[model samples]
Target chain A: MADLIALDDARDERLRDYTDLRDVQLRTTVEQERGIYIAEGEKVIHRAVAAGHTPKSLLLAPRWLDNLSDVLEATDAPAYVLTEKAIEQVTGFHVHRGALAAMQRPQEREPREVLAAARRVLVAEDLVDHTNIGAIMRNAAALGFDAVLLSPRCADPLYRRSIKVAMGAVFSLPWARLDDWYGAPALLRELGFTTYAMTLADDAVSLEDVEPAERAAVIVGSEGPGLTEHWQREADHRVIIPMAAGIDSLNVAASTAIACWHFSRR
Target chain B: MADLIALDDARDERLRDYTDLRDVQLRTTVEQERGIYIAEGEKVIHRAVAAGHTPKSLLLAPRWLDNLSDVLEATDAPAYVLTEKAIEQVTGFHVHRGALAAMQRPQEREPREVLAAARRVLVAEDLVDHTNIGAIMRNAAALGFDAVLLSPRCADPLYRRSIKVAMGAVFSLPWARLDDWYGAPALLRELGFTTYAMTLADDAVSLEDVEPAERAAVIVGSEGPGLTEHWQREADHRVIIPMAAGIDSLNVAASTAIACWHFSRR
Candidate 1:
């Protein structure tokens, strides 16, 4: 069982990891150096604990401690009971969720390893928005996508905002960074996967028309300039979600959900 | 042709609408009162123009004026061309998109009118988050949802951020508010529509099992507290997207997409 520590000072040294979060640069640097991120809200904290990402410490109001007794009992981390006002002061915002946990970043699997045994994988290329990345992971996890592979330009999935937005699915989903863009396609093909690059090109096959195979991968791109021409040309198939003619395209994350659902159904 | 006016002063009274945007309450008031919103970026501006939302005025760097010449030809709204520094000063931030348009909110149709002729519609109840609302609309539009109907508690579809996040689909798709929630489900049925409320109850039929009818309305709720019991009881069918065990539910917007796509296919 976790030790329950009472804290009244907002500036306690033990709470340094959760301080000054509104400063993006400082937060990013702290995340990079310490390799940890904060998960907000009781649901997300519970999810993180359930996924085996053991928290370093849990912070909550006295009222919440009883509610989270089960979660706290399952772990050896210290549960810091703080006044709601103190927590708000420390976190630099009103903590609406009543509970939060700071957890160390876990090591990510290699892209090849994440894809090796996968039947359906989502490959995100240059998806820079953290919220979109988080949303995609949540959708992928819910819809039964086996893994997510991120290109070099994609935002960090374990970022604080992404973690919050993903509802802690980022901790559970198998995600890997692929730096070698040129060789990644070959690796997927070697894994016996048919890579389906999502694009809006005229010649691409509609998502409804694409036949489902045993192992398939869906590649999504950044919001504005979608999948690169090289990727579209090199993939095993270019799949298009049939859309209204005048409409530009669905948002990247929404498109990812649609593609994942299609592939999962198949 | 639009008149090109040069403005070097940040304190100009004409630039009042573009100032202090980081203040949420002030901006919300502006959105509520004026029924007008700002569209950022050249692409979104172009989309607004394509959808027939006339630009009240265009604020851009002098260099972008030449690039926007063709788009400006159709509008008589004054185009304010300012230096990058002046534009930044006026908007209180660096306008990286190099252009912004003040668009008049188009008149909304009655919910009955939108539903009366539509084969498929999306109904949102108390979905307060603008981004989620926008994402839902974008998904609905992309996946063949003919119209969107919002209950009284739902977010404003015409809010500036919603319009931008939706990629301007709020202009393209038919949408309206239901001031009286008690009468909504009955009105929907009266319009020859079968209401399918999305829920996670064990007894609810899977979306796959709910055979699509001629006209169907897929109702979704906010993230935390789902659809009201009143609305749930009124639904002709309560359907759920079969999710993996341990996962509570997909995001409301994503679930709506999956449900919409299933119905669209039928």
Candidate 2:
């Protein structure tokens, strides 16, 4: 069982991880440096623990202690009990679910390990928005994509907002960032996966027209400019979701969902 | 051409329509009562004007004036020029695009008028999030669904955030809100549309298995509860996008995108 520590001050040094949760820029850097990721609410905390992540500490409202007792029992981490008002002051937002955990960040997995047994995969390139990363993770997992591979600059899937939006899919979906994004297409091909680059190029084949392969990797790009020319040229196939005339493209998350659905194995 | 009027005060009574934009509850009530909607940024403002929504007034920084001169030349509405800091004070947030317009809300169109020529349509039921509504509009428009029909309680697609997220697709897509929520399914059927309710029921047919109808209307529900039992039973078919086991469902916008793509006429 966890040690229950009652705290009255929001400025306590132990509550550092829970501070300024709304400041994405600052949280991203600080969390990374601290080697921790925040798991918000009961469900996400449970998922994180279930996924083999160790909790460094937990912050909970007095009312939520019993509700998350099972989770607390699973970890020896110190559980700080405080008023909901104090939580809001510390976190810069109301703790809607009244439970939070600062989990020890898991070691990064190699691409080879993540894709080794996967039959279908999603390769994300430079997706900057954490929400998009979370949504994409949910879409890919729900649609039966076995794993995900991210380009070097992709947003952290474990970001609190991403984890919340993904509803714990980020915990279950196996993903790894590529150290060398330029060679991703070739690497996937070497791993016996046929790669499909999603783009809006005029000559690209319609997504519906592409035949499903035994091992397939669908590459999606950043929100603004889309797939880099390097990935677009090197991927085995360039696919487009045929859109109505004059519409530029579907939102990245939306298009990823459609692509994942179109190539779903189930 | 619009008369360029300089304003130093954020609390000017003439800027009533542009106040408290970050406060959703207050803005929604106030804007609806005043029969006006805010179009944020350069692109959305232009789209609103092009969609025949008369601009009551425009708030812009001096830097944005030249960029929007063509639009100013097209309307007789007074343009209020102010510093970016003053705009922040008025709107309660930084106006990144440095331009905003208060456009007269177009009178609600009848369902029949919106669906008369649309072979494929989307029916949204109580989707409370403006961003989701906007995304759904962009998806439907991009995927070739010609019109949208909203439940009485659905969020306004012309809300500033929605318009920005949708990239002004709301201005191009024909949409109407149903007066009688209970009679919506029957009304669509009466208008020659075969309604398909998207649900996660065990007995629901897979979306891919359902053949496309000549006149199809896909109905999606609110974020949490999904399609109500009433709509699910009354619609011609209950269709589901088959998902991996243990996963609940995709984000509404993502699911809507997949559904729109599957049922696309083009």
Highest lDDT: give the candidate number.
Answer: 2
How far off is residue A5 in model 2, in Å? 0.9
Residue clash pairs of candidate 1? none
- Model 1's CAPRI class is medium
Please give, for residues A70-123, the per-residue lDDT of candidate 2 as tens digits: 888888999999999999999999989999999999999999999999999999
Instruction: Give each model's clash number.
Output: 0, 0
Model 2, runs deviating above 4 Å: none
lDDT of 1 by residue, B1-266 (tens): 99888888888888776777556668778866777788888888887888788788888887787778877898898888888888888877788888988877777778878886899999999999888889899889988889999988887776667877787888889999988888989999989999999988779998767788899999998878898999889999998777655555688878877887788877
- Predicted structure with the largest DockQ when compared to the true one: 2
iRMSD (1 decimal) for each model: 1.4, 1.3
Residue A70 lDDT in candidate 2: 88
